[model samples]
Each structure stands twice: as structure tokens, then as C-alpha cells.
Target: MTLLWIITALWAVSFSLIGVYISGQVDDTIAVTTRMFLALLIFLPFWRPAPWRKSLRMMATGAVEIGLTYLFLYQSYHYLSVPELLLFTIFTPLYVSLFSDLLARRWPRQFWAPALLAVAGAAVIRWTDLSGDYWIGFAFIQAANACFAFGQVWYRQQSMGNPLPHRARFAWFFLGAFIIAGSAMLLTADWSKLPATPVQQGVLLWLGVVTSGLGYLGWSYGSTKVSAQQLAVMNNMLIPAGILVNVLFWGGHIEQWPRLLLGCACLAAALWLCRKRTPAPSRST
Candidate 1:
């Protein structure tokens, strides 16, 4: 399980590079479509869906929850630095916690203490040397997180007992992603100006196969094996992990050690909360 986390962190970093690599070749729509198409190719052979039997609700859910959200996020790479774009992701757990509270009809008393701590830590990160685009990118990142947080909750609620296995779920998601992202590409991307260099093509291929297909597969597999709260905690680490990787390989720079320390402290607190045992529901005496 720990190994899974390490693997995911490494992939998380690598995926950022893939995003930068493709920024020049394809528009967000095509890159997303290419990713989905590759993932679908890997999944479709494994899980065959009856052409007409796939439900409209399932299709729409996949499109909104996964496809469109990813489209916006991949586009963020073009407009924002890796570190700046990742900071926006700090809002995911906050939004998820809020949504969970609303849907459960009960606030998460356990989360509030650590949540505040996490926000304070993120604020520390912000105090470091700021870029002009950071503020603007923050807005887009928040929008992306809103979509992801809402979609994740809705998908989990609606699909908890869904008969489709993980592979099948991936298939459906990719199918819908292909439809939605393909349409967006047709409208937004200039097909004539596609990249011709081997390095560019290699990057796109890796993005599609490794990051889009295998990364999602690994994440879904790990999700099934872990609790949701644990997953949330692990997600927070993505920011630090992403930044560290970019700094080492892609010339990513951080101005202050305080930001790093604060972020790590916040992640530690979240993970601690996630690891706490929950009491079982009791019947009325």
C-alpha cells in the first residue's frame, strides 16, 4: 500500500512533464481526446460493452465527472507553471469535505481542526515569492477543483454499488471522454498544425498511454483498496511531490523552505486524521 503511494507520487510528477511536453503540440481538447482514446484502446479489449446497452446516465456522468474536468486541467498546464497549477489543487480536499458534509446532512467535526491547519499551511506556501500568473491561475485551478470535487462525490454516490468492475468503469469513462473531448478538439484545435517531431510525438504517446491510461488504472485500483479519507490525504501530497519533481527535472523553483515545511506539516496532519479509527454505527438500545 505504501508502495502504491510512492508509485503514484512518482507518476504524479512525471505526468506534469507530460503535460508540459504536449503544451506545444495539441490544444487541451485534442490532448484530452488522445489520452482518452489511448486509455479506451487499452480498456475496450478487456471489457466489451454492448453497443446500445450503456446507459445515458453513465455516459453523461463519465463525461462531466472525468472528461470535461480533465480537459480544463490539462489546459491549465499551458497557462500556468507546474507549481502554480498544483497549488490550485490544494482546494480539492476542502471542497470535498464541504460536499461530504452537505450530502451527509452532518458536518465532519473531526475534519475541521485539521482542515484549518491545512489552510494555514497553504497560506504559508503562498507567502513565498509569488508569480504574476499565480493569482490568475489560481482562479482556473479553483474552477477545476470545483468540477473535480463535485464530480468525485457524485460519482462515488451514484456508482458505489455499480455492477461495472474497475476495468469496465475505465472503459465507459474513456468512451465518453472520447466523445466529449473529440468534439471539443474538432471545435477548438487546429489539426493542420499538429507537431511532427519525434520528441513531441513521444511525449504525447507517453501522456496518453502511461499517464492517462496506466495512471488512472493504478489510481482506481488503489482507491478500491484504500479508504476515501486516506485517498484524500494522499492527494494533498501531490502538490509537494509535483513541485519537487518539477524543481529537480524541469527547473521548478521554490523561494522558501517554510512553504515546503508548512505543506508537509499540513499533509501529515491530514494523514493522521485519515488514519484515525471511526466508530461503528450503533443501534438504538
Candidate 2:
């Protein structure tokens, strides 16, 4: 927990920064690859080799989660409005729940309720009219969501069995991401669009070193501390938190107060459900 909540607050500001400073100003591939590269370097000093199997697993998770997820996510902004992008991400909580349950091979009835409620809460705040190309954007976001959900769940489960501390083993994860990200950058990047201004350079540096490096570390470690239900619901918390950040500092506006209030209430209830103890699903199921 606490790590998760803190990371949420940190990430809430990241979207706005990318939207204002990086998008269209920099090539997505370059920006992403640079972040992954810098993030990998941050953890290099603490890097320890896990068992071959565990190392490969973390690498795969990083490729799918950070590499593919960011690629699809950045592509999505091209096809979708900011509101549309936010709306599409409302499905992430559901994906997190589904993947967690399926991977565990058990029906955790208690987890589903809060996850669905969290979805509802997030959708309430972010839902808006779609543009004509929504299908493509939606598909990209869903792919990102699936990758992200599976990665976190896989990491959480594996963390339980791993002997090494989280910090010591995270370098492999970032290295995996860098491999994929760097390849994508090589293939798709526009050299002309690299950071030109001091502001842009500064933004990239902050995003790469702090946002991607420390942020992912906090999230990975924190995911292992919470139940799947809580983790699922927390995925949605970023929506409202991000919106609030945008409105307060970035000249964004809320379209509807009622929707915001209702959504907040639903999110509160979902969080309460996560905190409350419920009967576990029988093993026979």
C-alpha cells in the first residue's frame, strides 16, 4: 500500500506532463525508449541476477507491460481525444481482476465486486462522446490494459515466491523493457523530433529518471502487498486523481460536477469493499 498510493499521486501528474510537454513535441518512440533506458540504468547498481527462470519471466513481463503497453498507449493518443483515452482506460480494473483470477485458477467472488464497482466509478468520471476513430484507439488502449494488468499480476505472484528483495531484482525488468523499447525507437523514431528545447529536455530527463524509474519500482513492490481486489480498484483511482491534477494546475475543467461526485462516491464504496473482509470463494469452485 502506501507505496501504491504514493505512486498513484506521482503518476497522476505524468499524463499531464506528457500531454503538455512531450506529445507532438517529441517522437513517442524516442521518448519511451529513453525512459526505459534511463530507468534501466537507475537500477543497475542494485541489480542482482535471479534464477534463470525468474530472470526471463521478469524480462518478459517488462517487455509486455512497459514496452508494448507504452507503445500502444502512446499510439492511442493519436487516434483518441484525452477524454476518450481516459474513458478507454476505465476497463483496466476489469482486466486486472480477470487476469488475476484466471492466473490463480480460482473464482474469487470477493475480488470481482469491488473491481466492477471501480470500473463503474472510473467510467462515470471519464465517459464522453467518441470520435470516429474510437475503434482503433479503443483497441490500442485495451491491448495496453491487458499487457499492464497481466504484467502486474504476474509480478505480484512471482514476488511472493522470490527470495530477493524487490529493489534488488527490478533491473532485469527494466532491461527487458529497454530491449523492446530501443528496438521500437530504432524502427519508428523521427530523429528530427528529438527534444529541441531546454524545457523539453528537462521534461524527458524527469520522466525517464524519476517517473519511470522510481515510479515503477514503487508500484511493483506495492502490488505484492495488496489483495487482487484492492490492486484492481486502485488501477481506477488514477483516473479521478489525474483529472483533479489536470483541473487544478493545468487549466482543465470538469464537464459535470454530479458525475464527479457520484463517481467519487462509487470509488469510495469500492475501496471500502476492498477493506472489508468477505468470505473467500470455496476451493471446490
lDDT of 2 at 278: 41
Per-residue lDDT value at 185 in model 1: 87
Best by TM-score: 2
Q: Give the TM-score of candidate 2.
A: 0.82
Per-residue lDDT of candidate 1, residues 1-285 (tens digit): 574576568666665665567775666676678777887898886675644545455566567756887777876676667876776576676666555555555444566666566555555666654556655555566677776666555555545656777677777767776898888988888786565678777777777787777776666556455555555556667777787778888887766767767775774565456335222211110
User: Number of the top candidate by lDDT?
Assistant: 2
Off by over 4 Å in 2: 107-129, 254-285
User: TM-scores across all candidates?
Assistant: 0.75, 0.82
* Per-residue accuracy of model 2 over 1-285 as CA lDDT, tens digit each: 788989999988987788778888889999899889888888899889778988999899899888889888887877765544665566676667667767768554576787678667756764675345656776788799889998888888778758887777778898899999899999989999998999988888898898888998889888877777778778987887887787788887667778867876776677567545343322221
Global fold similarity of model 1 (TM-score): 0.75
| Model 2 poorest ten-residue lDDT run | 276-285
- In order, what is each prediction's RMSD in angstroms? 4.8, 4.5
